[model samples]
Target: MSFPDEILIAGSGPAGLTTALSLHEAGFKVRVFEAVPEIKPLGVGLNLLPHAVRELDELGLLAPLAAAGVACHELAYFTKRGERIWGEPRGLAAGYQWPQISLYRGALQFTLLNAVKTRIGADRLHLGRQLTGFDATPGHGVRARFLNRATGHEETADGRLLIACDGIHSAARKIFYPTEGPPRWNGAVMWRGVAECDPVLDGHTMIMAGHTRVKFVCYPISSQATRPGAQQLNFIAELRYDTTELSEREDWSRAGNLADFLPQFESFRFPWLDAPAMIRAAPAVWVYPMVDRDPLPRWTHGPVTLLGDAAHAMYPIGSNGASQGILDARVLTGCLRHHRADPEAGLTRYDAIRRPATTQIILSNRQQGPEACMQLVEDRAPNGFQKLDDVVSRAELDAIAAKYKQLAGFAIQELNTRPSLASPTA
Candidate 1:
């Protein structure tokens, strides 16, 4: 009738790996299972907002993260016609205690992976094991089953609780909601590519050009991806289609044809960055439907729960997806530590706090989150405008950005003054 002092986790993505580090720091045993036999720098770039960065800082990873990627100095928006609509300082520039780190998703993943290996011990990671199912007995905790992908053999792992961070197509999510269906597609296709190019805007700026239906997001993830003067820029070109059929495959690793979405952004040329030219120069491109699952009413079920894309797979708007998962790791670990005497209650508490928070974000991203400003300008001035403030008022822009930051839990003042989710108990 006591806590087992051990935890089992599935999927070593940012969420699971961060959970390992957080829980281990809180003095618990954690074993992480990853589906891939080897974890490499696979995906393209992403941003870790100031709030998420703060959590990593608590874990003493700020130095390494700063070393890995660029700390974005600004987030600027533009119309499809290539005129600046709204621009604001970001990270430390905006006064947040932590800077928003823009690095390749793989770089961030390996950052978490390396910390886990060093802090949690390399032996604790079981690669090539995919979660098949799990059974949680009333008093015996949870016994989870996984397929050893390398050997094609079944293996079982037992722990006081199980956390699933296996990503959008999560196996743990399937076991819970067998009828949930695939991630809801917004009928928009996203073509993502990373190219080493001359710096666009400022080398440290993240820019979103265009509006709701058609948009281009670009930023430099690493200056080190290439030689001096050229930076590694990750870009996503998105276009909405009026079709219900998901004709193209939806895998994140699916290769995409440049001919498809590149033509739409042919006019995305500005004095600073030429969108079409950048796309053509890219060595590779990946396409996937812009998709997210509807928020679940619950994430924790007894001793089992979900994290990251498993719990809330949201559209990547306002640069908040990975940041939310990192927040989840800190809160989940903090809750369990607070409720050490009743760990199951901790799962419920973590669910209560994070689920509602992420649900709001998922719904907001559907409506374009803070990026709605671009759509507003596109609607009013489709032909482009001479003066930026004439299209959208400064007050309106401020409101949009403020609302999202507040909802996303990174409002400058609030986040700067908020207490750490990493409990001081440990």
Candidate 2:
């Protein structure tokens, strides 16, 4: 069994596409498969953290991304009562070499898709090819089977490696661990929607609101919409609930009724933004359990492996869900580039570096994610705080915030001081 230079990637989302583009740039022949008949703009907002930005920057994509996205400068935490709890600089303002971006998920995906097409050619992407199964060929490559969505006919493809970026509920992951069960819900049901609203706060600030029982967060994803003063703002309404049922673990397009959970936000009227009005005016709403799997011990099996959500789907609490996936693509590409002589060694190295890093984030997101600052302030003053200083000291809040930055592996100082991934071991 000999390793080939070509790889077959399962999934057309950010992780798979990014991996394909990067690997192509590294001199690897890449092919990508998507389960959908046609790729449509699904899902809502996602943040492009600095770490991810660095990867895109290296790929010469920063300008195109900046043209299509909004650069966020700060993230603010406030109580439902409209009191500012904590605020920190974001993106380049936070001293990172790269800036942070917030945009519609579809816009980002399309941007990456376009880039991949430009670099690797449109023929590289195969739509309507749902990855069904795969097997390692003795010691070196993977033979993958797929069900064509349009023809309903079977197809087979072979490559030196198979990557499952198929996302959460990944068919590739299921093939590996069939009995692992559905993604474990974190006891928090979240409803998301985009609102056409005027600038809130600094307009670029991402805000976290409410407490554990009735927490909500919103931020402006775009400033230029059809009407003036109407920005495309994204909001997420989360509440604690039992998650034993696995009936609603559908894809991102699952529709949610406003009445199902609007009662909690009925009274949530803040001076900066009217919560109920925004929710009501939204033309579309998506609902999903704020859930993630406990980190896996490893993501590699022979020539087949996992990447992105298929690898480590974590709570979106820290705004690292998509960014982490992009990071995985970059690191995996780095490994593959360095060890092309033995591609299997590259897969093993990718696992060694990223599995532990992402595993730490998965567990941290469950325990004390970036939202911990808001949680601490809310817990101290449930009703209302007479004074911000009395409710929680600035030092305490800063420490909590800094800890999350470190854990998420994007602390500006740490990244600057540490050696790059190319320098043997980082």
Candidate 3:
């Protein structure tokens, strides 16, 4: 088969947009198809680890991203009783060349979308095109079929390569893994919201309290909440319920009621911050099950492949989901650059390099990832702790943190020394 010219990208989320940007920068023609008719600043906050931030920096997006979100300074873990379990400097504070960022998921998407349009041109992006299916033409490229959600029209486009970044419910993924059902639920439900509140700690610290069964995570996503001494805080209150089955649809925008989970944190007031107050002050709360899919043995088939959540959906335990997807975009682009003469070879190399790397993260997240520190403290000292060392040693905590960083491909020294994933020409 002969190498074709343009690449077809499905979904306009972070993964797809980043992939489009990277390929376009490498002097490749690319087009992105998004299911949403229009992009909006929707969804809550997300973290971009230092490694992921490095990729964004190479794309010349660091300035806009820093403007949209807070550069996190520290990550601390605490118990339900409001006692600190572990604390460590993060991002630049941790000596990384890049800083870890906390920003709204929608803001990140829109930023990437704008970058794509500015670089690749607006005509290359096809909105309201919901991917229904795709086919690989024998001696030609892949033919992707889409349903125009706006006009009820069917459309078909052909590309040399088809990259699926359509997210968890990706139609392309379904076609590949036909037997796979809905995402596997881990019996936990998460209620997320953002509130304008006084800065807790340093105003740039990310905190995770409680254990696996019941937990609370809070951090500021933006600096827009300038009410004298207040900042915009994004938070998630998660609880593992009795039923293992997912009762409601897995929608990110599903409305949630405070009455259901408020009692659990009724007495969770602390000197620095009030968990209950933050939860109540939010304009709205969205509920979603903490779910992920079993890592697939393969992510490539001929010239078609998957990326981001479509390829590897892991629990949001360690803030690695979006970061991993960003890394996917970078590595895949580099592979394509190396194997441009043979698109199939590029797809295969991308799969070989990313599949195993993300599979480990998927399994690690299932074991709670770095959040294991919180659970360990909870298990060792269910009531409370006089001194953290008395319950768990410093060495144990250090080991947990180090292992996770290494597994997530963000070990401080390693990340600093690693070469950029950008194509040589780029």
Clashes of each: 0, 0, 0
lDDT of 3 by residue, 1-426 (tens): 454578999999899999999889888899999998988887999999999999999999999999999999999999988899899899999999999999999889989988998999999999999999998863357989999999999998888989999999999999999989999999998999999999989999999989998899999998897598788899999999778787655988889999989888777788987999999999999999999999998998987999999999999988998999999998998888888777678888889989999999999999999999999999999989788889999999999999999989999999999887766312
Kindly report which residue stretches of model 1 are placed more than 4 angstroms away from their true locations once superposed: 1-4, 424-426
Which ranges in model 2 have alpha carbons more than 4 Å from their true place?
A: 1-3, 416-426
Give candidate 3 regions above 4 Å deviation.
1-4, 424-426
**Which candidate has the top score in TM-score?**
3
Candidate 1 lDDT over residue span 12-91, tens digit each: 98888889999999998999999999988888999999999999999989999988999999999988877888889999
TM-score of 2: 0.96
> Candidates' lDDT values, in order?
0.90, 0.85, 0.91
Better of 1 and 2 by lDDT: 1
**TM values, all candidates:** 0.97, 0.96, 0.98
